[model samples]
Target chain A: MATTAGERESSLWVILLTFAVAMLFSVVSLPEFIPWQLGYLRPQWVELVLIYWIMALPHRVGIFSAWVLGLFVDVLTGSLLGQHGVAFIIVAYIASSLYQRLRMFAVWQQSLIIFVTIGISQLVNFWVENFVGLSQWDMRFLLSALVSAMLWPWVFLVLRHLRRLFNVS
Target chain B: MIGLTLLSIALMVVDHLSDLLDEVRSGLTVVVTPVYIVADYPNRAADLAQQMFTSRDGLQEQVISLEEQLLLMKVKTEKMSALTAENNRLRDLLGSAAKLQDNVLVAELVGVDPDPNKHEVVIDKGTQHDVFVGQPVLDAEGLMGQVIEVSPLTSRVLLISDQSHSVPVQVVRSNLRLIAQGTGVTRQLDLMHVQGTADIKQGDLLVSSGLGNRFPVGYPVGIVTQFKHNPSEPFAKATANPSAMLDRSRYVLLVFTEASLREPVIGAEG
Candidate 1:
């Protein structure tokens, strides 16, 4: 059966809204807040939003979109050109491919998986960076992934409303 | 599927063409700057309100004391100028050109990266004001970071406290050179590749060794806070607290050198 017109419209809205949120999230804060900063609690708002959209509407947010988003992030964050694009494409594919299994898990369980996905993404980022002859490792990578995972629930709730507003299923 | 494959291949090629893409990157920076400004308006208003509501007496006292300190520092600096001139003269005689970076344009700190793993700051300066990628940023006390992304009227800086940030620095005490990398936590920096027997200690000041040529020489970067020599390993792990107040800087300076714009990254003492 064909998807409902409302669902299709909502899907487009969700993807665009998510992209805006990711862009804003990426540029909004300098990592200077919070005292005694734990490395695990870093916010991966973009990845979180991307995962949500990819799972919610795989048809709209696909490999090409993820790659473009990652490219923008690369420019925004000043990483090597393809560094974020590669990581994002990998994470987007992983999250989307496993969406069926992931959707069935409890919220907490899903957060754990999200954490792992982002953690793996960071590792991939580190690996590619090193391969490009820019190798430097610090504990913050794991910490940021963990923290971003922890924040997934709240992010999901917020983005879900945006999805509703945009009429995305 | 073939179309997608072709698109991916095209993107991969464009991604590898870093040098050729600088113009496009710079152009994109110009295009999205307005978005950042609109998003940052609320935060700026809140900060302004907070500053306006601060206790009058507190603000007055701060200004008075700061002026006094500045006067004292000015007197001391005057005394050191002649000595500096003599040092420069000697260096000039030795055929070493004195490399001086221009003073930076002060930029407002609009936002911090929401992610703690990536220590970055968005500043209100961009290509519109001639700020370019790789411009050195400085907080009141010392080195902060470099501009990594330039939107038309805004730019993002990667702070020295980010894991991705690294710089070549020399221990003020021993002049031992090492690469200092960010630990992704505010105020913490780690020096890589120091043997256990190295003559570095806690409280040692690390200055930009000027060897990297990316950063101007003689700026304070950080102070060694922890030094551990593991008997099991040949290398010692050292951490420094960045002198730049990354957490509190409301205003920062972005130093741009027109001459160094296209210059290669200089490798300094390792």
Candidate 2:
């Protein structure tokens, strides 16, 4: 059901809050003792959170929103500008398109899609960075996709809980 | 989606190849500063916990050890002062530029770069504290990196171990000049293009030669940890361990050389 105007406005704030938290998590590094080894083990928090928001409220979040969030990530990570925007745009388009079928899939099945999509986005990033000769030439970047896929179940559940608790559409 | 991707590519090209987006990045940093502050809480909490949980006797022992170290350092400085004066006289006789004493500002590590591949860290000092891009950062040990981007309240330092970073170095023992390049590993730097007959050896100290004017002259940069001269290859290979604790030190010092200070103060934070 379409919500009241006030509720909708409140949901937008809730949505933005979730995005902010995701950005915070995305930039925070692990302890010094734990070596991430080229971020092969780090999960993509922004992409995961964006996926949740788009799947839950596709009408509100779109490719434009993802592009904007990607720019935010670029600044946060100190990468070349718009590095993440291209990947987010591509992933957001695919995600928004299949969000319907995604809602019906089991968590594990959805995670398979998560693996594929994150892998694709990572490739896009790899390509862009490679163009500037910034990325190391290795297949190991896919390890992050594996880690993101494994974390998808928990991320989906927690974000869903937050959306419901905030009474977001 | 295609149109947006094209637009993103245009932005990336501009950013990677030019300084056009530097202002944009710094302006957008206002949005990131608060997030970084919140993200840094865990590190702050861990440090706080260490202070809180340390027994009083433990702290006293640390203080005693520090005092002893300070006394030892003072003795060394007394000799160093005389040596520095003599060296300055020698340089003046040779009609060379005398070394300028550097001004250093203490900065706290606010955040580490989330990307593990890019060895960069964020420091609390920014334009607000006269920290500028290309300023050298040092840990208590030795050279760490240079500031590459400055926000209003924070700046980012690209560490010496970043894959894209390199510094001009000299062997203190042999006076051999070399280019120490980052090999994308923590605390490890490679001396590139070593001639087959170079005199590099393990345990030799590498100091900043300051040829490129990027880092301060005479700062400890690295130590030759491994060396090999291959007969077949055109060049030999040597590796060094950076003097700075590349992966550990949370407190870093930003150095203001005479060159960096010569620029006009564009705005506030003088």
Candidate 3:
């Protein structure tokens, strides 16, 4: 789609606002604020947000942004630096490369793809965490991937609505 | 992609092997602190509103109970003064230096580590408040953790239950010293290298030995909750529940003790 000068300028603002809100969601939805027993069920909000943006506007949200955002998440969570950065870059690359095909899929199929993408990211994270001896082999780490997959349809709809409202394209 | 992955690996290795990236992490933390403040706003607002709407009768009842507890504490402190003087005399007789009382600053928890595998928290106090890495922290009950990273306005605490953390502890009843390692589980620590014949028992109070100088001596660390001695094994496995409420504490005390003021030897704990 061709964009006018005004549309391009407004798209920049919309992108920034969406990313800021996503970061806010990642920070505010930490499991610490919830009951301790249910901490393992916390969804990967930042990952899901990255996936949605990359899928929607592959040309705009690319690998560099993913890497930087991952670093922000790492520092925010006080985890090993670069752990999330690598995972995010991989996820962003896959989403952008598959964006055309992804757009044609149903919401449920897209969620299944999200499950695979996030699961891959989680695996990368687990591998790095294991390399540094920071994490053990536990099946519970995959729970976030499952939860993120479950939430993908709603997230996709909300972001789609906001994108249309702002003429983000 | 490969180049970027390689760069990230290098960053991680550099971060783990030295203090080179600490300054970078602290600088980035300044940018991220606002996110945490914004995240905490709703909870803080609710607390404020709750306080404002509390009934006067309820406030009065709370004040009365607090005053009664204060009175009881004052009586106990009066007795403590006499015991302290006698203890000082005994130390002098033994030609040992008198223990200096530690000064403490109260700090509120600002953020908690989101990773379920890691037990850590950030506090409001930081380098500006004279908070240093390795400074011991405590809640009302017992030792909580030590500062691992300090930024300008905040610091990160590695809790005693973190997988990477270990503390030297001694049994109060038997005076047997052992190392307690964090099991990555809340309120639990594993005593490492304990012999099956060791005199540890259930409910034995474990206190910091102050041998490594990382933590101050005689602070309650935990109480033994389980001891298993398998005849086939060379060492007994024992676990203790930490005295501090690692999961529930909201405020903690930063202790400025004389020993902690000394420079911490790098890689000393290993």
Candidate achieving the largest DockQ: 2
Q: Write the per-residue lDDT of candidate 1 for residues A58-127, one digit (tens) a residue.
A: 8778777888777777666656566677778878888888988887888898899998999998998887
Fraction of the reference Cα-Cα interface contacts (below 8 Å) that each candidate reproduces: 0.31, 0.79, 0.46
Q: State the local distance difference test value for candidate 1.
A: 0.75
Tens-digit lDDT track for model 1 on B98-121?
634354578898766644456777
TM-score for chain B in model 3: 0.91
Give the alpha-carbon lDDT of every model. 0.75, 0.88, 0.85
**Which tens-of-lDDT digit does each residue in B1-270 have in candidate 3?**
778878888888898899899989888888888877777676577779989999999999999999999999889877877776787788889998636356678888877776778888888888878889899999988889999998888899999999989999999999999999999989789999999999999999999998888887888999999999999999999999999988778799888776655432222110
Show where candidate 3 strays beyond 4 Å.
A1-10, A29-35, B92-100, B262-270
Best by TM-score: 2
- Report the CA-based lDDT of candidate 2 relative to the real structure: 0.88
TM-score for candidate 2, residues paired by index: 0.95
TM-score of 3: 0.92
Residue A28 miss distance in model 2 (angstroms): 1.5
Q: What is the C-alpha RMSD of each candidate to the true structure, in Å?
A: 6.0, 2.7, 4.0
User: How far in Å is the alpha carbon of B142 misplaced in model 2?
Assistant: 1.1
Ranking by DockQ: 2, 3, 1
Q: Chain A of candidate 3: what's the TM-score?
A: 0.90
